[model samples]
Target: MKNVFIFTVIGLLFLSCKPEEKRTDYIINGDASGVYNGVRAYLKEKDRTGRERIVDTAVVVNEKFTFTGKVDIPKPSVISINSVNGNLNFMLENSVIDISIDKANISQSQVSGSASQTDFDAYNQGYAKLKKESVDLQNELRNIHRQLSSGSSEQLQSKKDSLTDLFTAIRQKEQDYPLNFTRTNTDSYYSLVIIEREINKKNANIKDYQEAFNNLNSELQSSAAGLYIKANLTTLMVAFEAKSRVDIGKIAPNFEAPTPEGKTVSLNDIKGKVTIIDFWAAWCGPCRRENPNVVNIYNKYHSQGLEIIGVSLDGTRSQKDPKQAWVNAIEQDKLSWTQVSNLSYFLDPVAQLYNIQAIPAVFILDAEGKIAAKNLRGNALEAKVKELLAL
Candidate 1:
């Protein structure tokens, strides 16, 4: 009898000690009463495959119309609650999340655990500083203008010189202030050991910024405010990479692909001029919208040795006919540039090499093979073409 009791106790302890497997579940708890509708609750997981899995369910609540559901969610789960009311955003951890919406006029709001006071405070401070600086600068400029208007010719010139000096001083101070803030914030976020490791690993080479960027946490990586703190780190990295890979006053990276005319064209064939390689796709809305601008650039500078090579990434998986769509868009938009695509679409080797994340991406190569500038769109693109081609 003694042995039996001891064995039973041992068995119970063993069972209790067993680790519980992670689970996925639906849990909704919040005020469902009032005019709340268009509230969506679901389980979204980024599995081993790196694909998102969304599981939807109806929320269950109490007499007050509160919604709750118990779901066995896996560890490190991401929960998305979408409400049309005030556009609520929230996140949950472990089990049992409860939400109470006091706002009625909006569809969905106050998804619990999503708001970050730290982020809000940081962004607010940064924006406020920016606004104050702008106002101060404007006021200063107006005062200078008023002084110039009231002065004689020689007095006005002296005042103008003084104003220019003041402007230069202000600009320098502005630049210095941001750099100081970024450096200080960087130290707070990254350890001295980590930063030294980063700097040494890159050997001060700017191109290695991307590696450091990739090392950032996913949340920090996704946040623009976070990136801003990094000090335009991506741009710096790209600039370094370009410097190392491509030489100034040399022919740029040239390749060939089939144009809509079933003819092959290479960058060398378009040599002896500045060229704009536009990386875009039929499915990209921004690229479509910017097409008009590109067309205008081509027309304005085509005669002045400015050539364009549009590389489309709209792979065969898209709904539209790739060839016809490219052709039709070109003809309709009057895009008189050399257009080509390898048909690999997003998986295009060139895009991967360049680390392009969004559409309407462009790189302008001068008469030499070097990348003169990147993402030159709108007035910027036009200004660059005119300046480089002396148009």
Candidate 2:
């Protein structure tokens, strides 16, 4: 009888200690209720599909909202709100939360909490500080450009030196923050990655600015930001094999390929004049579309020592069309400049030499055959060539 009673007591304790899994719901009351109702929400789940859908909600007033759904309390999920204005994000982690964001910056803004005032204020403070700093830097850069055009040699040098010192100080602060956070084991991996990328970009821009200011030539100096942005993008591209990010003015690696007439051409052959080598395949839509722009630039600047060499990555497909796909596209597109291809597709010698992982790659060489620019496309290409050739 005593043994039976002990077993009964154990059973009751086990039932009482079982984990609780209850269905719960919360209303995410907010300002601009109609704005939330008018917007659609896409819920994203990593490593899963078919979990996304448009959110249907009812708005009560200008600054009130009701989110009705069955949710498990204490679990986290990301809700992405999309509207005509833009996207807003929220993290649902608690049983109840009230979020209020300024309507003006809603597109780029986000907030998260579950009835907590402390976390909201902390997040907003960091966001506001970052935005202010970004704006101030942009304004300073604009003023520097205006002053650059009018400054004498001595004045330019002095200004350049001062800017360099300022950038160095900023970099030092950036490095210290990373190191300090790393020691604390509190820095998130993604946050560290973002910080590293930003620091590298900032340092690169600073270096480019120093070079431009030192050059003194109006044209060369004017293209600094454009060049910096392009070089940084190209460095990130798969074609460049850039282990470390490349800076502007660095010499591109030498490459070779066969001309359309079955003659081998080397970079050395085009050393004396400015040459723009166009790397494209016949199958690429963007490549075909951009051909006309290339032709126009060539026509306008060819006489001014502008040499464009077309390196086709097509062989079989380009030969199949009525005009022969690539050749037809070229002629149809009115590409009358110099053309060459080994018919090797991606394996083309020139493509491999320049690490051509993508179609529509371009390299512009100066009079001395050093790399002047890379990846100048669309309006940027026209603007750059006009400046370089002084058209």
Candidate 3:
């Protein structure tokens, strides 16, 4: 009876001590016939913002390689030789994934074994076909132009017009295909993957992003990709509509930033006067060169209700301190106008709000704080200031 009791205690301890292997363990096996033996392989993953993490490494042995690791959830992974020679990418789901490469062609290589990876490959194959057609149309158009330029131009114009239209249609389809997929596949985690490529593009589209974001399932919407979009989509929308934001007829977007003395100052702080919101950087050569011209205008117009707010994009990198750089620039340039900076350089809140892409950017506001003119430099800037103050 005592031995039975001891055995029961031992059974409980054995169960408790056993490690979890199924939930965490993932096995990757690959055969690359053309890739030389003993080549190093890197397994990299990204954490939401698309920053790479080299989780593990392996070496090819006898034309084969394997990686065994554990992960809590599926992650986006790039299996590459060294760091930059990317082999292929797949959703590193918790499964025994197999890769087969033939004759140095990574593109034609077959990746199998994980259900999520199967879905990824199928979707990617269809997407690749669509992209190829887009490229083919472009190449055909370019070829036609070359033939026309070198030979007789008869019947070429009509062909060119039709080809141009076809190219435009194909381009639009290529851009919209992934967006449509995201909208339809609410359950798949890769749906977020498709939408993220669109969202992170230069001057991202607001309407499409909003629609795709709404279509995401609750599970995906709370994931890292969704959280990143939630944090940044508004900022992108504002930046994308910068032309409208900077147009002369719109009310200037109000921005608050710290002054040279560490006190917060905003557009509203000096609202009753004509203001020139000058975007400049201490490190900007053009801004430095143009400072004398700006200084002259400020001296001439300051008494006449012309107020200049110098927005400095400086002190963002770890190598330099923003406060000291701003003060030094102001003193060196003999800038008498009020200056402010968040010290985040280009990503400064005000800079992002105004969609200030270029340095030496200027926005002149009228007495009521409405945008008067934009990006007017030197004589144009002085002329506008004089004209507005005269009003």
Candidate 4:
């Protein structure tokens, strides 16, 4: 009896001491009282490629809907109902989240239980006010510009300038809001989202944004959004350094590629007193259309010390023979300047060196090989070439 009693006590202690299983799944209990019964509700989120995909679906029964799922991390998601004009946006985490859906005004829907959603809500509440002010200012600016388009008198011009100033001020605020929010809400997952956006901007200051990202809590920094930013930051840094190397007043990066006749030519070998490094591809319609203008500029300026090196990005996988297409395009367009290509499409090393994202890219270099101007086409191209040649 004593031994049995001891075993019973041990069993009870073991049951009491065992750790509870941690919940990894989310249960979204939604109250859609105002929505019609039997309507379908969709839980949607952006995939890695930024495409909105439906993650789960549920049917409203008795004006209520429920969703059960698991997420590795907090994700920005939306809950949409059939016949609803817009979706209810929230941060979806692995927890029991209760949402009171407002059928008429989806934006007014209330969400509870997800901490990340609370941070997102707080950010949006402040952002919405600034957004509204910006919209109002933009409307006023548009009205002024419309009036000016008819005929710009001094008075109208003054009004337009004032409105422009105000519009610019509001825009600066809008741009700064995310950074400010991130600074104060370092623990919020939304901060990582904002940092990702800031990193993706064309002219993003990598240093400042990198500092902001580093300031985030260790857990937030290791999240999906943070990891994405970290990877893209490295890419952006490479492009940024490339851009700096080719900026106006900076020496153009030198490169060599195969000429149409199967001869390799380097930029240093072809550069002249006034050089035009024209990046184009045979398959690019805009580049083809712009060829005539470039040809005209070359013909007029070639004898006067203007030299052009046509770098073709033509070897896409679709083309059977990228080299033949490039050669054919040159002949078809009457491009008489020195032409070169690797027949490797956008993967051309020269194109990568110059940070060429699109075709019809032009970089005009002055006497000493410094970039004088960029992407100047039509009349602007001719004028810059004339200026560089002192004609």
Task: Please name the candidate that would achieve the greatest TM-score relative to the true structure.
Answer: 4
Off by over 4 Å in 4: 1-27, 35-42, 49-69, 82-85, 142-159, 195-211, 232-250, 256-273, 279-296, 302-305, 310-348, 356-361, 375-379
TM-score of model 2 (CA atoms) = 0.42
For each candidate in turn, give its C-alpha RMSD to the true structure in angstroms: 13.5, 13.8, 10.1, 6.8
**Alpha-carbon runs more than 4 Å astray in model 3:** 1-24, 32-42, 46-53, 57-65, 81-86, 151-154, 232-244, 247-359, 363-391
How many angstroms is residue 78 displaced in model 2 relative to the true structure, after the best TM-score fit?
20
lDDT by residue (tens digit), candidate 4, 267-311: 999888799999999899999999999999889889999899999
Please give the CA lDDT of all the candidate structures: 0.60, 0.57, 0.80, 0.89
Off by over 4 Å in 1: 1-192, 196-251
Q: Indicate whether candidate 3 or candidate 4 has the larger TM-score.
A: 4
- Candidate 1 weakest lDDT stretch, 10 residues: 187-196
What order do candidates take by TM-score, descending?
4, 3, 2, 1
lDDT of 2 by residue, 1-391 (tens): 9999999999999999998763366556555543544554443322112244444444345445556565432222344444435445444433556655455666444444453223334444555655565556556656776777786477666766676666556555554443333233221222222222443553343333233233333432234333443365445443223412222465656666665556777666654356788888678788888988888888877887788888888865445542256667677778886677777788777777776778888888777666778888988988877777766
TM-score of model number 4: 0.70
Candidate 3, after superposition: displacement of residue 313 in Å? 12
- Which order, best to worst by lDDT? 4, 3, 1, 2
TM-score for all models, in order of appearance: 0.42, 0.42, 0.58, 0.70
lDDT of 3 by residue, 15-89 (tens): 999996765578999886767777887788976678788888888888788889886555668777742244677
